[model samples]
Target: MRSYLSVWRLPSAPVLLVAGFAGRLPSAMVPLALLLMVQQRTGSYAVAGLAAATYGLAMAGMAPVLGRLADRRTPRPVLLAQAAGYPLLLALLVAAVLGGAPTAVVLAASAAAGAATPLVSGVVRALWSRVDPEVRGTAFALDATATELVFVAGPTLVAALTVLAGPAWALGVSGVLAVAGALGVATSAAMRRWVPVPDGPRTSPFATVLTPGLPRVLLSGAALMLGFGALEVAVPAFAEAAGAPGASGLLLALWALGSVAGGLWFGARVVSVSLPRQYRWLLLGVTIGLAPLTAASSPWVLGALLFLGGTAIAPTLTVQNSLVGSIAPAHATTEAFTWLSTMATGASAVGAALGGALIEGPAGVTGSLLLAVAGAAVAVLVTLVPGRRPTRGRAPEPVAA
Candidate 1:
């Protein structure tokens, strides 16, 4: 606790922390908000689901492009542009939903809003590199923990807003919050001071700031998120099937709580471990924790298991972020982080759809849970792929671009 407090006392750390939290709050709210808005407007969950998937896909597709831009220039311009554009796009989406606009139009607006989603998580994660070396790991751990909190609270906020005002208001409020947070960080002194270093001539067209080990990092991230996506859908299905639909949220919250606990504990450790090795061990824990979800017959059992499983979430992410910082070229930190975000989003989307289908089909919740386990297993496999030794104290120099 003292160590975390000390980190916050550093210049601009508090500002970045608060703004990043606020900026990412929208991510938790937007999907549920969109679901509620579209479902209320169109009377069709199928359409609403499609709209939500479209939004996720669009965000997944555009994050890399936007991240690359941030790498080429600086995060400020990219973030500022998003800050100005995203809310407008969200408003347009709301108008289309309420006005009985064509499904295609609503989908288009959703994609547009997604494309303009502020690059908050990436920017905040990238800032850890600028912190003192001794505290960098702690900073990353705190950041990951905070993100877990965002996921936990974001849904609660959406539910509250929907009950108090309506779904449209919930969506609108998220847009406003996202805008404020993104703009706040973009204009901060820390962000401005951290400018991009230019990439020298590179042979590979696909190469950005991503270094050799990053592909494995991204694949691991995807697998982790893919398992999470399955867990997200499967938990609800389990709750409903067990005749305790209300337990779904509680179970999920328990999972987030576990993640928070894990992150704090992981961060506070005073040990010196390499990122890749820590990541490998975290994935093992995650797989072990999640493997039993298939056997859970009631919400009580699932909740306990989920909380245990969730303990791996923050630790895994914290290690993943640390690993990225270790290996990413100095010039492309933001882009590298964005790629991680993109792969997670894309994989989660796919996992959600697959989980839902499996649950609806003969395979049932057990199948979905098994798939989640498989995803985590795949993550472990990816982590084992031979790569350069994990960066320990500084960003690796770019390979002869």
Candidate 2:
């Protein structure tokens, strides 16, 4: 509590937190809203799924490029430009979808819209790194928890809007939120004064990727999210199999609730371990927590296990954020954080695909759960790979390109 209060006391923290949440709402809302809208218009889940996937892939593919631009140019111009462009692109997408456009046109519009999605998540995270070092961990923890809440809240809001006025209305609201949130952050005092760290002799295009200890952190984070992606699928399937399909949402929400609780608790404490060691142990905790799910024969049992397992999720993310901030070159911090988002997005897609296939096989939901555990275990192993220790308390000096 004291730690969180310390974070909240920072001058720009409230504006950043609120605006960041609003700006990131679209990330949660758009995919489900777009899927429902396209499916309603096209009357095919297959087409809708493809469009949604295309949108996500486009966003993931373009985010690092935009982040790098922000790293060089500062986030104000980048966010301001995106704040204007994203809503317009989203409007175009909605128009194309509702105006009875062809499938190709709709898909292209979805891709364009996603490519223009605001860079709020990365920018906000990078800004957290600029906060005083003593409370940076708590700030990251709060950010991670807020991100989880966004996914939960975004879907609920979309469902409400969809029920009231249909998916297009839901999507339009998402665009509004994106624009307002991005503009708010872009015009903030902190963002207005932000300047990129001056480039060093070794600051090349690949400096972020080549930073010692960063590759392992990124790889482990991806593997952890891979587990999460599978769990997302497996938990719902578990509910459906138990003859309580409607309980799926409740189960997943409980899982997120547990994560929020864990994050708040972890953030308030003082950690005694190095970030790398803490990262490994947290990954291990995820793996151990997941291993018992194979034995869950009922939704009640599965939900309980999921709630317990989810406790590790945000703490792990907090450590990952801290490690990235500490090890990445100051010149490329935004890009480094964006790469984390990219890896998580891409790996989660793969995990979801793999889980979908495994769920249909003889192994069924059990196989998916095992895959989830295996993914986390692999992450633990990745952290043990011999590498330079991540420097704490400050950004590392740039390595040779």
Candidate 3:
């Protein structure tokens, strides 16, 4: 607790934490907001789904490019550009949706809005890496926990605003938060003065984002997210099937609560093991926790198991961030983190789609849980593959700044 408090005492950590939360709030809000806006205007869930998918695809495709821009120059200009453009683009989307514009036009505006979103995740994680090493693990833990909170809060906010004002207003609020958060971060002393340093002679500019050990890290992250998505869908399906559909939200909340507790406890501890070893163990823990869910016949039992499984969430993410710090070239840290986000997002989408199908198939929710376990197993396999390990006995390249 004192260690986390010490982190907040740093000059800009509190501000950055708030900015990160507000900036990322849209990540949880935007797709739903887009879906609501499109559905209200068009009265077609199909079109709304298409529009939302386009928005996600746009964001996923552009994140790496935007991260590269932030890396090559500075996050200031990148954030400034995004801050100025995103709200306008979102406003355009709102107008297009409300004004009965063509579906194509509305879709284009949504894509533009997605592309204009600030690179908050990459910038924030990269910033943490630049801070004190002693607290970096805790920082990552806090970040992961806060992100889970955002997932919980953002949807509630959107639902309330949508019911009160309308989906357009809800979307506008997302734009407002994004603009405010991006400006706060962009103008901060940490962002204004920070620079990425070169990784010396052997590092190629084009190859920076693809550092040797990073691909496996990214793959494992994707696999983990895949498992998460499956669990998400399975919980809802299981709850609805058990005739307690309303319990699904509470179950997911409990899951997040467990993750929060795990993050706090894990962050407060001192570690002696290597990050890779810790990650593998955490992966095993997550998988072991998930195994019991298959036997759960009631929502209450499933909820308890979900909470147990969720306990591994933040610890795994903390280790993953540490691994990225060690593996990514200094100059392209932001891009590398962005790639992680992109892979996870894409994989989660795939997992959700697959899980939805599997839950309706012959095996039902059990199959979905099995698939989630499979994803964790794949993550563990990726880590254990001998070829994935980086070479030892070589000194790490120094930052040139």
Candidate 4:
């Protein structure tokens, strides 16, 4: 609670939150806006889906590598470089689309956007972790809640903008927002001044992951996100297949809104429970929360069920992030945080593709949503059961890459 409290009380919190808002808004636009763009442009969902997949894979694959690079050196330079690079790539994407470019061209443009995405979430998490030990878990909760806030506000804006001016306006608006967010982040006193420990040479993010406690945290996060990410894609396609073509956006919105409410509710509190126990319970709750989604038959009913099922999101994410900071070596904290970020992104991409493929022939969205539940359940089972022996030690540091 103190960490959460101290964060806003910090002199820099105001400016940093603004930058966070700017950086996060694009996530919504990319999934929904790009889907609309590619679907409309090539007159095929398959091409659009592939294009989006390329973007996901590119971002997930490269982000950890970029974060590892940032950790050894100053984060400011990385932030500034991305500020310059991302906008230009986005501009190229807009141009390619308006010019009626081929699928490869559009796909390439999306990949460039992915490659250029700044590690805003990772940066923010690292900063929050350094704030105060008493408040670290709450801080993580606040951070996770903030992410949900982005989806809430960002998608609502995209929906309104896309409806009024089409996906082009949404894309253009996101590019401008990204620039504003990047500049805000790059120039922040905390960001400019923040540096990894080591005061020494840099190490690989993979090496950071190899650290005992970190690998476990990263693995847990990956397991949770894999399900959530896949559900995002499966929801829209499932809605269309379920005889409710117009319900996709609303259903997705309900899911995000549920997370928004749950995240805020969870973050605003302070608890003394051990981090591992917190994580275990959160995963168990997710397993229970999501169990009913497989049986939903209507969009309205599904929306209500999703809202209830979202209760696990904030708790699970907050605990995962808190553990990352709690267990990280001082010198490699930022890199360690970035690895967790990368895990979620990777899981999401894998989930989306897996969910999409599962829903293809006879499985449908019902089965796809069932897969989501199963993924979360698997995470819960892995943590509590033996034989998956954790490699961490009481006082061991992460293996240096």
Per-residue alpha-carbon lDDT of candidate 3 for residues 218-258, written as tens digits (9 for 90 to 100): 88889988988888899989999999998988898888888
Please write out the lDDT profile of model 1 over residues 1-401, one tens digit for every residue.
Answer: 88787778777788788899999999889989999999988899999999988898888789878887887788898899999999999999999999999999999999999889999999888887667777888898899999999989999999999999999999989988999899888877687677567665556745753467888898888998898898899998999999999888999999999999999998888766767788899999999999988888789989999888888889889889988877877777887888888899889988988998999999999999999999999999998888765343234332200
Error (Å) of candidate 1 at residue 396 is 9.8
In candidate 3, where is summed lDDT lowest over 10 consecutive residues?
Answer: 392-401
Model 1 bad stretches (over 4 Å): 388-401
- The segments of candidate 2 whose C-alpha lies over 4 angstroms from its true place after superposition are 201-205, 389-401
What order do candidates take by TM-score, descending?
2, 1, 3, 4
Off by over 4 Å in 4: 1-6, 199-205, 385-401
Put down candidate 4 lDDT per residue, 1-401, tens digits, no spaces: 45455657766676677787788788667766877877777788888878777776777777777776776685677778888888788888877877899878988998998888877777777777666465555666767877877877877887788789988788888877877877777787776556555533326425567765666667767888888877887778767877887887788767777776777777777777888788889898988888888878777788898888886787788888887877766656667777777778778788877897888858877677877888888788767654333342232222200
lDDT assessment of candidate 1: 0.86
User: Residue 272's C-alpha lDDT in candidate 2?
Assistant: 82
- Rank order by lDDT, top first? 2, 1, 3, 4
Candidate 2 at 305: error in angstroms? Answer: 1.4
